[model samples]
Target: MQDKTPLTPRFSYKSDRLKPLRAFCQTVRLGSVSRAAEALFVSQPAITLQLQALEREMGVGLFERSGRRLTPTREGQLLYELAQPLVEGLDGLESVFKDKVAGLDAGELNIAANSSTILYLLPRIVEHFRAEHPDVRLTLHNAITADGTDLLRADAVDLAVGSMMDVPADLSYAPIYRFEPLLITPPDHPLATKTKLELADISRYGLILPPKRQITYRLVDLVFQQHRVPYTVALEVGGWEVIKQYVAMGMGVSIVSSICLTDADRGRLATRSLKEWFPSRSYGVIVRKGKYLSPQARAFVELIQPDLFTRRDYDDSGHSER
Candidate 1:
């Protein structure tokens, strides 16, 4: 069998090898040496040695080991937080240099977004981009709010559009638009007759909500937690499409972003503003830290004209909801 013993713990040296820093950040984020090693594409021993050298240089223990897992010390946590953006900037710098040398013009753009963007934002942008660069292909992927950012980091997509909260270090974001969440129900649903609601009254019905970890769900939970309201979740689905369909079928009422609505859906589902609910859902364009945006991709991003809801061209563009 291969040797599994850990090598001697040597503290980090005062050298400028960024390898150790990268390893440290990954380990802190993932809480596992093996996982960090795999991410960095280095041997476990190499990663360990670098960390040891780094610890020696810093003169403080960075991590506390407990059986199989590793947790960052307070200092380590602080350092990891500071280093993430710096590392991402460095990665972006390197990519810019490589792109400068390659002399490439047209390339593909991979965009991942929630159905809301697919419905409200993409059509006009796609049309404008195609008119400018007919040769370049623009592909957009759709996911629930939770999975959008992960898909960007995993290289499953080049850019993502969704909630900007806790965006990863390896990604850059540009705010595109903002809107508020609304309570929606089938036109004849009990809540539709009313123009507004109190928390207790809304909570009385079975709720169709996004999973607790999802961004929208967090917002909803925060409101409930702050108001000390009790509510029952009848179903937790991942996507807005599913939620809308269920609400349309009279299964349950849903709290959804206003961007999820369309003219066709307006009559089918009655939307009521939640005055106490958070008034904004801000979405952005997220790209990998070091990836070069092709000329076409650059153009696409530039054409994403941000405007207030009253000024939106949603009616004329006819975007099909995904």
Candidate 2:
């Protein structure tokens, strides 16, 4: 009689842990066990079993049934946030490994920034990054905060360099540079000569400001509303340079962040600190949560702040393998 060969299992204990987690992540993402099974090309029963096993291991009910679809429980949602990245990183381990080996030699790094940030903040950083990594293609999209946030959510840009006042939960804003708010006017403007300025004093004059849709307008309005002070906007300009020119041309007085001030600006415009009344503005790196910074992206971010994105939360996780 021929000796029967013992069959080896397809998945090991280590792989067993990985499979269930992948299954769980997929079901949570796709919102259907059958859809996840089809996407992963696993049998429906196997997907259900894997999900059941995961729920047992996690010691919690992972899903709340909504008709045929499923929504993750609170605990399950949190677990998905943490595990999705891990699963993605492990799945793309081969390509990420290859990218690391390839280095930043010839990859592209896309960054989003407003005109103000590109004009005032990123020039030196961009110059140095270009000098160090000449082979890496760098493109900066001119985007306002809302547009930049949209680009980040769409993964159209790797990161953004700007200031954020109210950071949303899905994005991370780390302000590396701080600048005091300033009141700017032509050197001959009345308020420019006042030794001490008050919010009421500033409110008396028409202000030239960015369009009301911008954060600066929102912040200015917020401060005014909080203090019960009334104000007016003489002009709704788009760019800082235009605002400065309008102020310089004696169109109106305005408030701006000191980040835009240069020696040339100081020569033409009288600037006074409004920090006492207004909060300081910050400029820094803004990245989407769970982003895996590419080599080129990482290098540029490090130039901005050596210790930036080193937090435990910014763990280097790559994109979905599937």
Candidate 3:
């Protein structure tokens, strides 16, 4: 038979307690016991007591006081660094677990979209849904063609918005818009002075374009390839906003979605249709094969779709059509 002895305290204080560790970390981060107390919604004396308890447990002074200012000592710095991550991680874990147990607050939603969709479509949708389902949190990730598709395949995102290119066999999409790309030139540029130009005529000047990874870039490439159009690309930007800025600077001419150009932008740049370019791009939503959607995600999709696909203005005869 083995004899059992009662466990004795190895340190001067209880090692299992988290309150002192948390208070010490908060004090160090905020730079004062009183400030930490205010932030934590505790009294100043309570903060002091926790810190003292922590220092006693460790058998070392954690902080040195200079008048009203409290600075961490060498040992305090080590302990502060060690305690901070654990305290924060535990707090986050607690919140997540508690929310899980409550059943009402469930999980998060992840959304991915291309640049144009994020800037043009998502804002109004997010705002409309957030009014009611404020408890659900959402993350939005934006990328170009293959990256966006990869995000969907990897299940990194619950929803995606992009040009309705070749969708994966398992996935589904709803076409939102069929939009023509407009040739853009800054108001001050010489090209802006021209009336009704063809793609061949515009190819003479330097062009600012999106990178080949983008769906718009792929469409542009297809157009040039089909017509055997030879052109000089002065810049290849990764983002649509950057392309717009470069065009606005009169650096080069660009082709972009006409809808992205607001009434305010009309004063800065000029847009004209290239009648020869017959191809139009389709933008739409992409969802996973068998994935279940949260209520917030479903609501967001509905709100944005109406704006993109279903807007109707009647004629004098009370008729509407594309």
Each model's total of backbone clashes: 8, 0, 0
Name model 2 segments beyond 4 Å from true. 1-73, 90-94, 309-322
For model 1, name the residue pairs that clash: 11-52, 11-53, 11-56, 12-52, 12-53, 12-54, 12-56, 13-53
lDDT of 2 by residue, 234-275 (tens): 999999999999999999998999888888886899989888
To one decimal, what is the Cα RMSD in angstroms of model 3 from the true structure?
A: 16.3
**Error in Å for residue 7 of model 2:** 23
Off by over 4 Å in 1: 1-18, 64-95, 101-104, 164-174, 287-298, 305-322
Q: How does candidate 3 score on lDDT?
A: 0.70
Which residue pairs clash within candidate 3? none
RMSD of each: 9.4, 6.4, 16.3
Against the true structure, candidate 2 reaches a TM-score of 0.77
* lDDT digits (tens) for residues 1-322 of candidate 3: 8768877556433555667777887787657988889877989998887887777778899898877888899999888656655665565566545644753344567888877777876777778767756777878897775787678755588678777667753456766777777888888776676776667888898889888767667777778878898888889887767788889887898888764777778788888776468456677777654334444455566676645324332122211121
TM-score-best of 2 and 3: 2
TM-scores, all candidates, are 0.73, 0.77, 0.60
Predictions in order: lDDT: 0.72, 0.84, 0.70
On residues 1-322, what C-alpha lDDT tens digit does candidate 1 reach at each position?
Answer: 9999998664444355567888897787677989999988889998898888778877899999877889888888777766655665466576556545643354567788877678786787788777877766678888865587778656667667667666554456656788777899898987888755787888998889977777877878888888899987889987778899999999999888887787879768998888565657787666654444544445566577534112321211211111
